[model samples]
Target: LYGLLRRNFRIEEIQLVRPDINLLQKDDGTWNLPITSSDNGAGSSKEAMMLPFIADNVQIIDGNLTWAKVGETTSLSIQNFTIRLKIHSINSFPNMDLNLSVGEMDSTMISPIKDIKANLKTSEGLASLDNLSLNISGGSIEMKGDSTLPSKDKDAEYTATISVKNIDLETLISQFVPEAKELLKGVVDADITIKGQGFDAKADIKFSIPSLLVQDKIKIEQVKGNINYADFDFIISDITMNVFGGNVVGKGTGTLANISNPEFNLAFNVNNIDTGIALTALGQDALLAQGKLSGNINASGNISDIKADGKISSDKLNIKKMGDLTDITAPFRATITKQDKEVNIDNFSAKIYGGSVEGKANIIFGKDGQPHFSTTLNLSGLEAGNALKQLAGKAFLTGKTEGNIQLAGQGTDINTLTGSTDIIFKNGKLATHPIQNLLSVFIPALKTINFVAAKFLSTIGDGKVNITTATLENPQLLMYYGKGQMKLSNQKLAIPSHLLMRCDMVAKMPLVSGAFVREDENWCGIDFNILGTLSNPKSDLGDKLKGQAIGSAIEQIFGGDKDKEDKGGGGIGDLLEGIFK
Candidate 1:
């Protein structure tokens, strides 16, 4: 074969393993073969052996390559470790089928593919590839397509379809958009089609991903959607999603007219959203608690510009916990709009802590991209006990209040929303609670761990709360008239010092009494001072009150003046005597 081809054509590298049976034959029956004449005797029963046209790196496993006369409708078949081909005839172009399997090939240019199998057929001037399966990441993909050969005067046309199942979304994204790897993850499935008229191709895509992560910590239990795309325009619709224990429906359309300055519109509807789940889906760090919400929102714009409008309402929203607050509920509603820079609420209202609150606000983005806010609000018929329940960890203060407020400020984040509030409360009461004991700096009996209060009345103003006049009374225990002021700055609170406070702690038994008075408008504590913050306090409540609190209970419990009659008292009297001596 090598000598015959060299006479008419240039030669290159050639190799063969079975040279022992190499042969050549003439048409007239003469032979040039590496075999004994005994094995190739003329008119003998032995037949000529068939040899392969060897090439680089080929392994023949189970089938043979056939050589037949051209234009004779002859057939041939070949199979090897890497390929299998069958041809019915070869005068010009006849029916042929091919299958190829490669262990390592790069299909998407993203990563090396493994276990790839492709099937192709050429028949009657039409060609097609079908059931071409490939391994992608930890998943698999199958594809099929067809095309026509162009005639001398016409162009080619093509169509293709692909299906993906149980594919890793993270793997696909990491290969194409590594920056978003953390923003999305989970299993993906899709059925897609692409068809063309030579120049402008169109695609129809349908896909689903389950338990995907996005926006850092937010999660969607599942999402399914479809897209229609042509040229620079695309539309997606019939999108459904489950997230944070809620259902979401959405639709949108966008143009790639200018990739850098794209444009689009999106609409979303939410129903019966669980607050706890919603918070998690929104990636909120401050909470994962109770509530339910329903709403609709729409937005339109490009990457550099946007606008939106929406409305949300909660007939009843409950939070089991928020810091110290516990088991609370509110009814809320807001109509919101946003045009590029700011979000504005036109009608805002809520029922909170047994209070009716109404307000309007605007949130604007600053030059530095931080949020700034402006708001005005009014609170009516609010119960102090209910309002303070969460913040104080105890709803001990009982009172009704009405107030008006105006606020303006900016915050770096949620925890740092900074502003000042002015509130004026009237006709509030501290009933039966040891709330007065917390003012032990002024109360005389609490020094002995005793709580003795019946009724209290006051008018309070945040940054202006004053006991301008107070009446604490117990027909059977104690009574007092008091006046004082409280100051607020930063986050700290100060209970006024000096004679601005007064107390007469006796009802039927005149056992103890204290007073606070003012001179030159400077009030002084006739007893002791009190100081503390809303969440924490500084002064000892019982420290100074001890000396003035030798009442009947002290006599019955620790034998105060009653000791004058216990001449042989040893438990506490002897110890006190020894200390004095």
Candidate 2:
């Protein structure tokens, strides 16, 4: 009798109790239901099953529904659901009114949403959502829309306006990127309008946040922006924020089609930023530098591989590390490129250290997570003595220095450095006490001559600076040519040197004249080594000179030729005997 009734008539009103429904979504996103029946024994006709029917209403009360994709463990479920549909007809182009309320909903894509409610009216292939609201992530969302239901001949289309209020950003972001919750904290509000056909959509959004904290290190205030999204791509405009005691304005475009490696192009302008605060925000010592900074920056590419260009200027900058550079105004520019865990700063120029500096640098991260760096720099008109004193705690030379340095190293330790330098010091004085005493032993006049010039070509490695070639000159009196090495860790020196005295100057120093050999018509020279620290030196000049003097007097006395022997030892023996006595 029930089978006969099902075949002959359509039920007008239907009701369901606390039913649990399970649905499986197919590959094409259509649900598969287990409501098939075997063909009626013999007399059942295809025309009977295809006949049109009518229903006044169908209702579900206190029900649960679970939906999952084929072969997937993650599922979406609605609990405590109540739904009522007033059906006008069940034929082609049917019409209905829908009222639905869901007490709770859970999905793998996000945290649970609750208290969903909606009211809709459908007629003649058009559906109007009078109201829809939900609560998610400590926030509320309200929406209203009109949609064209798809038929065999036409596709679906929709337009909607949604407003979201006071969403907890940390909670929302953690659903997508768990680690970000530790670095970001904020509240968000937005108003959005969306329009679409089928699966394609475009949205216009205006968003604002009152405050945000990053890594508990930087505080940003009053962030607002306008964004347009289409086909997984976004255009952002008129974004403004206050951070690090400065104001920033920016704009950009990006694509989130690949969420893990989104790509972007951005430009920003910053003004009146405090350098100390900025350094502290970046996890550096605030005492490294102090100033006000202004800059313009342009950047492109994904977060992991990006390139940037910028120009920055500072006012009243003071660099504490170099000691004497204070209240300096500086203009700087650079192009920075990053890829594969490496960063390169190219074509960088700066005004610093009472000089102009130009350079390029590279930093690469090793598998051990250590940073290795290389740099090449050209410096002009730098103060040599003051900078040296700041680094080594003593000034060995004083002058205006200019140089080119190429360096490569790992970590921040100076002992790991390997590099080369070509440097010159103009109008300088070698002021170390040991050097002055060593020179005075050979030429008393040198004790008073302070003006000097010097040049050095050196290589540095293994905590030592190897002076491959060096020259120091006091043009009127003497010059020294040397090769040496200094242990940077301890400032120990060992230099083998040759000293040359000018003939005109040597002629005036009678006491030292005969002990030195005249290497050429222009000068006389001696070989000696400058050993020990710069402050205290040891040398063999006195003993060498004494031996040479004795040799010279004996040669004069012996006269090494038959004619000279005959002509004599005229007063030579007496001089020698007096010397021996």
Clashes of each: 7, 0
Clashing pairs in 1: 325-390, 498-524, 498-525, 499-516, 499-517, 499-524, 499-525
- What's the true lDDT of residue 434 in model 2? 50
For residues 345-386, what per-residue lDDT tens digits would candidate 1 score against the true structure?
766677766777677788775445455777776777767677
Which residue window of length 10 is worst by lDDT in model 2?
Answer: 331-340
lDDT of each: 0.55, 0.74
lDDT by residue (tens digit), candidate 2, 214-288 = 666578889999999999899997789998889889999999887656678888898888878876775556776
Candidate 2's TM-score: 0.72
Cα RMSD, each candidate: 15.3, 9.5
TM-score, per-candidate, Cα-based: 0.57, 0.72
- Would you list the clashing residue pairs of candidate 2? none
